[model samples]
Target: MNKVIEVQKLSISSSQGCIVEELSLSLEWGKPVTILGETGSGKSLLAQAIMGALPRGLEAKGEIRLLGKTVECKADIEELWGREVAMLPQEPWLSLDPIMPASKQISLVKRLVSLLNKPKSESIAIDSLARFGLEGSEGKVPSQLSGGMAQRLAYLCATSAGGRVLIADEPTKGLDSSRKQQLIQLLKEHSNKGALLTITHDVEVAKALGGEILVMKQGKVLETGCCESVLNAPKSEYARSLISARNLDHQRGDLLPNHKVLLELKGVEKSRGGKTLFSNVDLSLREGEVLGLVGDSGAGKSSLADVVLGLVQSDKGSVVHHQVLTRPKMLKLYQDPPASFCQSITLAKNLEDLCKLHQLDRKDIPRLMSELSLNSELLNRKPDSISGGELQRFAILRVLLMKPKVLVADEPTSRLDPIVAGSTIQLLLEQTSRINCAVVFISHDLELVKQVSHKVVKISDYVANHSSELSSPLVTV
Candidate 1:
């Protein structure tokens, strides 16, 4: 076996405390290593340390050997990027160049790193785009594409340089089932030629990648073994729960109580980047009702949400909200929880500001926190200091305090581990139910949508299909 990356006693700590503790592992050529963990388990930190890309405040202590070389600092590993190793960061959509066309981004990477001619680089870029079902999106910029489309482009660019070892951090965050499967397969094939290291919260991805597995929690490895053994017969409690969350079958049956309609979309039609995403769409969201929206990536799910929330105007439709619902009464839980919070300040400060602006009673905080299982001390920490799951809980808590009439959650739990995701969703359903709030839940996971929604809508049914030269359909997200 050819060993490419070796590590010993790797630890990452921040001013708050230890983030990743004394982790050790080895990666060999043509074999994949998958790290499965919750949001705050230090998975990303480990990958960053390996890449010498840890943030400024974070401190890392460890020994990393690559290609029989001893790298000492960021500069030591700088030259190795794209030549020896490459990485796909979390939420890759945000990392893509906003002004550059998708195909040009891929072609530029191939041209710069692979040293290919213009024609060949462009040809290969098109092929790579087709490989990930992103064909015909060549001319579109990142913002002009859907969340999943941008993520695919980012992966193509990251791997374009023929990096021998690929580190993907939550590579499948915004993807639907088909795209997630295609990506895992591509990563598998890449590992056949080089080595792949994937850090994810998705259990299905770990099961499908089938090589070595590491189950991490709060900066510690609790389980490690062959993928089949570790997943099929997981020994750790957390690991078992992670897998269980994926396998369970249940539903949030008929939570509606014939309440008044909170919002209505009549013959809605929307176009982005000179292309139609969906047309002639009609939907009604009622008080205390949960409407689940499911569709392929780039199928205008998020755009529909915006239309309902009045964030985006539909080209040929009317969105009428109940007179009782105002801007503050309508809330949106974002796909990325951290985006909803003010990163510079403490969580408590952010919540306090909201409370003071609305003249809310501070006593409501404790009751909501208790119901959501959120600790009071978390308020003292900054947004970046807490886990994504906790941050999302706090986001919900913030919304609950406002007593919203309608909650449009856009892929709210896509980035979370199955276990915490399950809990967070449960908290959402329970809290909204208590508030008698209407919900428009958008998700890529069919099972999750089925379990939690009162009725599910396939947005593709309303989409009007048209071909273009890299139409670059900006399905709203």
Candidate 2:
């Protein structure tokens, strides 16, 4: 069998030091491989290394061969990237042209491949959109589309290139189960035609692809073997912990006898462009309850959260709070935290500033930071200097400092790895529960929603049923 790509003792590093160390693997033309690991574990670094698109200030050593031809230079890797090997990035939005309409962007890709003329590209784009339950969204720009829709469009554009090897990094992130299944099928089709290297923290995605698994951590390979055998019976301690970490038991004690409804939405109606997003919807969050808001992309999940957060007003509705509404009384956790921060400021200064505004005690900062597994040194660093996972944890801690009665998290963990995200969620739950805060957890990750929520609300007609078998009894690391 002809090998599509081969890696021998690959080491990726930067001025600060190594990120991926002496990683080695091979991918055959007919087979697909999944790389699984925790956040900042070098899974994505490996993918970028193979594509020859490592971020600035980063370089690689050792050998990488594509189609049996050695790729030792940036020029060589660039030459083969789009033509022979394509990638679906982790943040699809970053890869897309913000100004371009989804259809036109895809059409442009088709034209580039010379597979069809401009006129024919529309039909292909429409068909692709329809497969992902986005039939009428072709004319929409990236901003107009929901995160999941944008991600689907990104997949269409990348795979549309017809490359011999596809490197998909977290392709299914932000997708509901139906859309996720469609993407899985699409990836399988691509794998049948060529080779696939998927970097994911999703176990179902790894198993659904039915290929070998490569587990990495802290830039090193911990284990690699057939998917079933390795995931089911991981020999490496880290791999076993990684696989078992996702399992969570949602059982909890009953709400305190004095638990009261902290926030309520009464007869809420929201509409945009003459279309009713949702109407006459009533919801409530009680003290210590983790309310899971489940729905498809663009089904008004985030809009509803916005209404509660006072970011967006409903066309006809009233937000009633059991107590006076104040800046320190309610908080919202966005999917992307760094974007919301004042990046120029150090982490400690940011927290101190927020404390000053809220008149909160700054003494708890160090203790809270320690509780979240955050390094005290990070407080001296600017927001851009830290990883997303760390920033996310910091964001959560920032919000928690106010001790809000109601916390609204909008897909807070969508961008994080499963292990890091899981731990973060656990911390969020523990901290919130300690304060008896009501949490509105918004996410497309059904398994995660189910794992942590006390009650789940479905806004749309259907909730995609995710595979429950993917998780087992979690072993504490």
List TM-score per model, in order. Answer: 0.88, 0.85
Clashing pairs in 1: none
Summarize candidate 2's per-residue lDDT along 345-431 as a digit string, tens digits: 999899888998889988878887887777797788787656556777888888888898788887777756666776677778887
Q: Worst lDDT window (10 residues) for model 2?
A: 468-477
> 118-225 in candidate 1: lDDT tens per residue?
999999999998877887788888766767777788898998888978999888878988888889888899889899999988888888888999999878999899
**lDDT score, candidate 1, position 63:** 88
Deviation of model 1 at 373, angstroms: 5.4
For model 1 the local lDDT of residue 52 reads: 78
